[model samples]
Target: MSLIQLYDTTLRDGTQAEDISFLVADKIRVAEKLDELGIHYIEGGWPGSNPKDISFFREIKKVRLTQAKVAAFGSTRRAKTTPDKDNNIRTLIQAEPDTVTIFGKTWDFHVREALRISLEENLELINDSLAYLKNHVGEVVYDAEHFFDGYKANPDYALQTLKAAEAAGVDCIVLCDTNGGTLPHEIPAIMEKVRATVATPLGIHAHNDSECAVANSLMAVACGAVHVQGTINGFGERCGNANLCSIIPALKLKFGHECISDEQLKTLRILSRTIYEMANLIPNKHQPYVGNSAFAHKGGVHVSAIQRHPETYEHIRPELVGNVTRVLVSDLSGRSNILAKAEQFNINLDSKDPLTQEILENIKDLENRGFQFEGAEASFELLMRRALGTLRHYFSVIGFRVIDSKRHEEEKPSSEATVQVKVGGRIEHTAAEGNGPVNALDHALRKALESFYPQLRDVRLFDYKVRVLPAGKGTASMTRVLIESGDKTSRWGTVGVSDNIIDASYQALVDALLYKLVKDQEQAG
Candidate 1:
């Protein structure tokens, strides 16, 4: 297989995305993961931009990466200044990374408008920056920012910028679609011009403004670019960058390239999820390869065809990327879909069983009433278990009361809840105070059960979402609550619906605790 290098800039460019910020430790963790996945280069960050990035460079050195080289990113030296005297260049050198990536304005428009510098000065900046960094770092990768746009506007000047970096002894010149406006068909011809102009190896760094970053990157590779730059989950500024999760698999499976080992490729889905968790961002279910819904089959005709022949609906084997074919349970699901889901959950049932029909009816009825089981698999599992007569009742709620009050103007509002529950033969009553009524209820319920099931302490509520059911009623509408509860080992979701918001939240919370207790019991067995 041909070799294609994978360069990840999730730590630097990915953080430029809104609502995506990682601590120094998060960067190190992500870097380690990337190295384990056999990435060729891991861009640490712009050490000159922030103290956190500087600290990241220092800390990442402690990690002995086997396959990946850590790279520090920065920009070209300021106009009319010596590269060594420029603070950005000096700081990048001080970071002591094995590789240094510096971007310079290749577009004449940016140089004339943004930098307000002459064209010759911009070329000088690129040359000086790469030459100075090459003396300190083992490899110097020059990013020709806005290369595509620059080439379209001024082809001779764009090629000159690449020639300048090549003359400066840089290792590679990466053409960046900074504006993400370049089309896929345009990459090959442009790359042909770049190859003709410069002898250095070429890389592609694409943005997703046109929703074609992946396609553009692939086209660049087809046109002879060896290295591809992207983020783990396509996290970046504005729309995002090319998603390495999708690109890596395509490179390895489709193009017969050696980007990552088969074993490493299996961890792609988990890697994408880990980054989303660290960023505290919801994973997009519809993401191309690594998303939860990527391999999910829902329609009756599709599910039936998929069961007979796995490739009938799926483009690629889901297992090729470490993802499973999910048979989602919904109103549109057929008997075969139910049977498939039951098998996955380890709930034995015959395809022709009457219980299957009953469960399907129940699911349709519940869904029509606003219970979406597609995103609430945990709730669906519980429903299936109950229908199969295998669900165990861990506890029964006796009663609960919640109160909110603000005694003083200077103090924040406080909430208190009293919960009573019956476990086995004994009754436990407890009261707790919290920042909100739901929190208080959570605390009180956990307190009531911790004495009976010590494992309850490990189960914590991480996320809680409530949606008002559209019943054409505004204030009196029914509310649906979904609570995500987890221990250190695993997490699960439980949902509840009621006209009263607090009542709905309490029901979901109770189910969450009960689910934890059941799992603990099963494990103990």
Candidate 2:
């Protein structure tokens, strides 16, 4: 296998995604992370397009990167302008990137319609822009925007466009599926023709519009392209760019390519999730290789088989990509699932023990009543410990009441909750007000217990999600609540279900606090 250069466009194309924006510091930090991951190139956005990108290029110079060359992205010089006079070209040089990548129109349609220039003029534009930048920049990469579509329309013109960039001395010629409509079957022939046409090193930059970006990139590589351009977690405009998260692992493990070290490949999942968090987007749990469910097992038979031998159900060892094999419990769970979970929780339980079957039945019954423990593992652990008679009763709630009142139509409703709890023999009652009934109950419960268990002060509710079962029932349907709680050290999830939303919230809130106390005891031991 040949060496493949990984060019990441997350800092540039990824920011074009809706609801995704990064600060200058965020870009620099991401570039550092990419460098650590052994990425070859990091495209630091188009400096000539926006002030924020210009600031990123200015600020990133202060940070030292051991690997990965920072590249500035922009378009080729305009049809009627000289490279020296074009503001875009001038700003790209000023960015002082280790490399420069500029896109030029390859499609006959775009050359005539978008640029309103003759085909020969567009060729001159491509040649002149790259030839001038090659003198100023250490390396220049040319992106043939709409190359595949242009090849399908007018093949000769497209190949000539590439030859123009090659004649201008570009380091690499990147064929872009800008529309992302090309399928995998169409890539090899075009790539082979391009390889025969130009001696320049070739690259592939694909988007995910047809859900074929990863496939197309791999196919292009199989056909002799040496460089791949994509974004982390596939974040980009519209359907997003090719996912480097999927491509890197596929190249390393399946193709046996030497792009990244095995140690660097182990950080793939962390990198994917970190980028999602920085972009303020939730991680795609179903995404291949790096998702939460990438190696999770939910079926009884599948879990049993994996327990005996992981190869039965898993393709690659989850640890290879910094993930773990997870067994989910539900109505489908069997003895193997219970045993697997017990082992995961560090609890001692025999497979033949009646308590194991009992716990499994209890979980099935609870799930039947609309309680889900998939995202609420803390609650499931507590349930298992309780069944084993190993759990401590930190506090007993005697009663709790929540009241909501609105005296005027224009005024917001007010919620207040009072709680009475017993810590051993002493009883404490406290009342608190909050923005909602659930928040009020949480506040009152914490107030009533913080004096006895000061550790409760360290725990806070991080997230709350409510889902109504049997959707058409609306207000009358059962409500399931999932609460995420965290302290300075760790975070865990708890769940509850009831007809009343407030009661469901209370159950989850109680579990959240009790789980925290249980964690404290476990750490102490």
Candidate 3:
């Protein structure tokens, strides 16, 4: 098996997604995580693009990465300007990453229309930029933007671009499918042509406009491209870039490539989920390999088959990617699904246990009432604990009042909440103000419990998501709120459902605090 290099552009290209944005601190943290995964190269960002990226490059230097080399991204020197005089090239050098990757116009249309420069002038830009950077940087990677399209339009000119970079002593030449329209079957021929034209090692950078970025990258590697460029969770402009979460496993398991060790591969799910958490984006549950639903079995037949032989329903072991096989309890779930979940939770229950049938009936009834346990495992666990008579009562809510008003035209709306709760034998009353009713409620609830459970101060709600349930009646719907909370050491999720949105949010918030308290007590004991 040939060793293929994994290059991550999450901090740079991945941020181009409409919903994705990363601070300098986030970039540094993500870089450390990617390094921990033993990725070959980490493209920090374009130093010339913004202050945040510039700060990222400076801050990332302080991080002692164990394996990955940080790469600084930029474009070629401007038309008619010397490489030494170009500000973009100068900024890349100032960023001082381990490698410098500069993209140049490869398509004849871009050279003539976008750059508005002659074909020979564009060639000079590629050659001069790479040669100038080669002297200062240990490695210079030339990204031929729109290479496949360029090859299709003018194959001879595109091949000349790769030859120009190679002659300029570039360390690697990356063929970019900037438009992401190239079919997988078309990649082999282009790779063959590029290999014949240039002696330098080839790389691939693919976008996902056609939903084939992963396929294109794999195809490129199969055809002799050694370096694979992509972003975590497929985050990027347009549809997205090639998803590294999918590609890494594909390379390791399917292709027999050694990108990362088996141990590091197990951290793949955590890495994928962590990125989504940091970005404040809900992870796509159905995403391949690392998604929540990747190994989930819902059908009765599938669950029964998987219980007897996992390979019958699963393509690969879920543990290989740090994900677990889930047997969801829904209207479609079977007794085997409940048994599997019970075993996972370590509950002493047999498939033939009377309580098992009761739990299954309860799950079906609750699901019919718009409760989804698949995404709300905390709630599901609490339900099982209650049924098993093992639930820990941390606190009880007596009452709560929330008020929202705008007293003056010039003033912003204000929200205030008062919460009364009982912990042990004492009743605590608290009042607090917040930007919104939910925030006020959250503050007041925590304040009420703070005196009895001071550790509640360490618990913070990071994410709150609300979904309105389907209504069986006309013009009325219930709401479900999922709250993700964390302390210094760990994080967990809890869920709530009610006709009132505030009530639903409050239920989730209370469960979040209670869950943390119970967990802390258990750990302490």
Candidate 4:
């Protein structure tokens, strides 16, 4: 088989997903990332549809890509219109991309209903648009929209659409599962028939509404399609397009195909994360290969086995995808779990040491009381260091007081906190006001400490999460507070649990400060 081509449409179809919007600058940055990932073709948005896409096409020329060819995406000429006269075709040519892709109605149902044109006219539109675009661009791709459903609805007409594209001298004919409802089982027969009908090289463009986009894409390749079109992290309309994050690795590692170099493959996780950050979407942690939890081990047995031989639990080495193995601490943790964490933290401990068992029991007991450590590994590390008597005494909080009051119904509630602490026998006391009780407490605590540990000035709270544990206790329920703090270098999570929300927050806050102090001390050493 020839080398498979990777075509990314994140800037085009990915923006169609709900709650996703990318500026012209963002689209350019993403195109650069896709180029870095070694994708063969990038479909910039439809130049004819919107001004932003036109702006993107204008701006992207400033970037220098090494391998990828940027392609402008658009639809075929309108019914009763000539390719030269149609504005969509003219705009695509004006973009002057290295390649142009135009989707044409393939389903006879769509030709009759959506386009409201006769079957022959739709073919003419497909052939005329590609032939015209081909004269201007080095490569032209024809996307047969709803090709699978069209083939199933009317096999002969779907075959004719590919033939029309072939006659137009298209570089590739892409079969699109536009509705995303096609099952994987239905791909092999359809691809076999299509291959027999058209001499044009075939590509597969799948959607995930049936949760089979990735599977269907792989199946299409197995059935002899050489070009694959998808979006990063599967971002697209409806259930999203087939995820190149999954497809790329499967092709390279599983099928023994080289869609990208091994060095480029190592950057897959970073690419996935960068796109997520650009879209302002929280990454799906359970996403295969690139997600945070993809290689996370929490169960005691699983952790034990992976510690011996990672392949016992993981299908592939995490580092191959630029991810690391994470051991989560919970009630299910065993001695192996503690030891594994100790190794991860670079702390040496004998397997039979009593400290290991002691830490294991303490973690289990704390988890039983609703103190979660999985998301709060910083707090867990502090717990272990304190147990081993290696942690330094940064400062100790003596006591704290909080007051919240609202003067009138229309007035917002105001909170003030008073904090007292002792740093190496020097007593410091301070009070501060804030928008809420937790904010007031954090402000008061920092004010009381910054003068003693000046480096504390760099510390800031990044995220705060509060979960009510064991529901049905109403206001009396135990609350777990997880505080994420960061400075110039890095971020860490600390957790606290108590019936009092403020107290829980204070516990997390104190641990956060102590962890920062320890990190600073280690770096100085």
Candidate 5:
């Protein structure tokens, strides 16, 4: 089996994503993580692109990467410029990386349309770019920009472009799905053609426009490619690039490739999530390796079989991918699921107590009311703890009210909330205002709790989401709320349900804070 080298551009191509920007310090932080995760190469950023990128390269040296080479990314030289004189080449030199990758137009259409240059000039562009990077760095990689589409249009010209890169002595030639239009089946033949033409090591760079970037990249590797370039969580232009999360595990477990260490594999899930959260984006639910729903079983028959034998329904064990197997509690959850989940919560359903029936009935009722327990583990924890006599309350709200007015003829309504609560068996009075009454209530509650438990300082609301119950039909409009909070490495999620949005938010927030307090106590003990 050919050893596949993973090249990560999460800091480079990843930043091109809409509304995605990384601080120079943030890029360095992720770079350090990738290095520790044992990725072969980390593409910092395009030094010539902007000030932040330049600063990233300047600051990146301060970080130490164990098993990765920092590769600087940029395009090839201009239509008519020497390697030393080209501004792009100087940017690559200034980056001072051990490796530099420059992409040039391989498609005839892009040369004539985008660059307004002749075919011969475009060929020179590819050759000159690789030579320029080679002169400065020990390893130089050239990307056949739009190689797949170029091959489909003019196979001979595309092959010639790769040949030019090979003749220039590039360390690797990467085939790019620039427009991300290539399919998995089409990659095998294209790779075969490119392999037949070029002698240098080949790489695959893919994008997720067709939602097959990872599949296409794997196919390319199956054919002959040795280097795979991607971004964490598939962050890139358009639909994004091939996701490294799926690529790494696929190569390591299924393909006999040893790119990253087992320890790195453990960190892969957290790293993927960290990148997503920093990007201010939600992790894709269906993302193969580290997705929340990747290992979740929702079917009743599958759940039953899983209880009898875990391998009955799972392909890859969830733990191998730094994810946990989740028995999704929905209408699909059966008696087996109830037992398994109850056991996980340390609740003895066999106690033959009325509380067992009560708990199960409450689960059905709350789920019917739109409270999803899959992510609301805090709610489930509270339920089980309450049943087991292990749960403790940080504070209990006495009464809360929302004051609104319709005094103005054409003005948006204002919301102010007042809440009375008991903390540590003592009354604490506080009032806070927020954009919404719920926010005000949350602020007030936290302010009151802070007096008693100052360590709650690390706990802050990370996310707030609401969903209307699908099964609601009566006058009581059941709404479900999920609140996610975090403190350093610990994340707590809680759920609540009510017709009133403020009430739902308050409930979820309180549970979330209380759960954090409980977990902190557990860790301390």
Candidate 6:
């Protein structure tokens, strides 16, 4: 099997995806990850496009990558302009990278329609640009812009353009599915014909418009391509580009091809999660290789079989990608599911015990009442403690009251809240004013308890969201609230549902504090 090179254009093409912008610091962080992941090439960004990318290219030069070469991206030199004087060309050259990827127009229509250059002149442009870069840079990659669609429309012209790059001694001729509308079966035949003619190393650059970028890239490899290029998390123009997360493992395990180190295969999950967190974007749970829920089991049959032998249900071992398998508990959960979940919850459960049935019944009732403990492990932990009588109360809620009033236009809207609590044998009274009655109430409660727990300084109200249950309809029924908070390392989340929104919020708030308190206690002791 041939060794394939993995090129990541996440910082450049990935950022071009709708509404994605990364800072210079994060771009550097992402580059570090790509290097750590053992990618062969990291296309940092276009230097002239934005200040952030320009700064990133400059700073990244100072950093060292163990296995990857940094590549700068830009278009070919402008028409009737010298490559040295053209700002786009100059930016790529000054970025001073190991490999420079310049995209040249391959589609005759794009040349005629977009560039308004004659077909023969367009071929000259491709030749002159590649030749110029070959002299100045260590390696030159020619992305034949819109190569796939152009091949379908005007095969002779597209081949002529790629031939131009090959004649110019470019390192690789990258075929771009710029429109992302190409199908899988269309790959091999097209690639086979082109590979027979072009002696240049072939690379595949696909988009996700049809959601087949990974599959198509794989197909191209089978047809004789050596390099695969894409952004992380399938991010790019339109729908996005092929996701390197899928492409990497697909090449390694599926095809017996190798691109990254065996160690990178271990840390893949951590790298994927880090990128998503820094981007502040939710990862696709079903994303093939590194998704969190990739190996999760919910059905009774799958759970039973996986319990017998993980390979019965798992395609790859969870630890192979630095992730662990998850067993979800829900309405479909049987005794095995419950037992497995209990084990994960650290709650002892004898499978044959009557308590198992009781816990299941309680879970069903809670689910019906709009309580989602699947994501709220803190709430579920409290349930297990209450059921087992193992939970110890950390604080006391003695008495609380709130007063809301609105003065004239000159005065600000305000509400006052007070809490009276007895901690250990001493009584503490605290009061505070806030923007809303609930806010005032929360402040007062925390103030009253802070003396007993000085660690509350690190704990905080990070985020709060409320959802009215479907049972409410138009009447006064119940509301569900999810509260998330964190300290330094890990974040803990909890939920509460009640007819009163304030009560729901309070319940969730209480769970957050109690969980943190318990964690602190565990660490201290």
In TM-score terms, which candidate is top?
2
lDDT at residue 421 of model 1 (Cα atoms)? 93
Top lDDT hit: 2
lDDT of 6 by residue, 1-525 (tens): 789999999989988877778898988989998888898999998887887778888899899788789999998888998777789888888889889999999888899999998999898878988898898999999998899999999999999999999999999999999999999999988998798889899999999889899888989898989999998888888999988888888888889997876778888888888888878886777877688679888777788889889999999888877878888766677777778877886678998999888887898899888887656777777777778787777767787778888788888778999889787788899999888987898788788888889887688776678888876366587898898788886777789999988778778878887888877877798
Model 2 misplacement above 4 A: none
Per-residue error (Å), model 4, residue 396: 1.0
- Candidates' lDDT values, in order? 0.91, 0.94, 0.90, 0.94, 0.83, 0.85
Backbone collisions counted per model: 0, 0, 0, 0, 0, 0
Considering only N, C-alpha and C atoms within 3 Å, which residue pairs clash in candidate 6?
A: none
State the lDDT of candidate 2 residue by residue for 295-334, as single tens digits: 9888999999999899999889988888889999889888
Candidate 1 per-residue lDDT, tens place, 1-525, comes to 679989999999999999999999899999999998899999999999999999998898899998999999999999878988999999998999989999999899999999999999988888888988888889999999999999999999999999999999999899999999999989878888888888999999999999999999999999998999999999999999999999999999889998899999999999999999999998888988889899999988889899999999998998878899999888999999898888887789898899999999999998887777776677888888889889987788899999999999999999999999998999998999987999999999999999988989998888899999989899999899998889999988888888998998997888788888777777889
Error of 1 at 339 (Å): 1.0
By summed lDDT, the worst window of 10 consecutive residues in model 2 runs over 274-283
Error of 2 at 190 (Å): 0.9
lDDT per residue as tens, model 5, 1-525: 667899999999988899899888788888888887888999988888888888988887877667799988888888877778888789889889878988988898898999999998888878877876776689998888999999999999988898888988999999999899888989877888777888899999999999999999999889988999999999899999999999999998898887887777888888888888778888787778798888788666788798788889877777886898787766556666666677875556763567766666777877766778888877788877886687877678888776765579898666667778797669977777777677777777777778888888888788888877755555466788998888987776898888877788888988888888888888798
Which model is ahead, 1 or 6, in terms of TM-score?
Answer: 1
The TM-score measured for candidate 1 stands at: 0.94
Q: Once superposed on the true structure, which residue ranges of model 3 sit more than 4 Å away at CA? A: 48-62, 90-96, 392-437, 440-444, 447-450, 472-475
Error of 2 at 324 (Å): 0.6
lDDT of 2 at 335: 91
Off by over 4 Å in 5: 351-357, 388-396, 405-415, 422-430, 447-458, 470-476, 520-525
| Model 1 steric clash pairs | none
Give the Cα-based TM-score of candidate 3 against the true structure: 0.89
Model 6 RMSD vs true structure: 2.2
Residue 160 of model 4: what lDDT? 94
Worst 10 residues of 1 by lDDT: 369-378
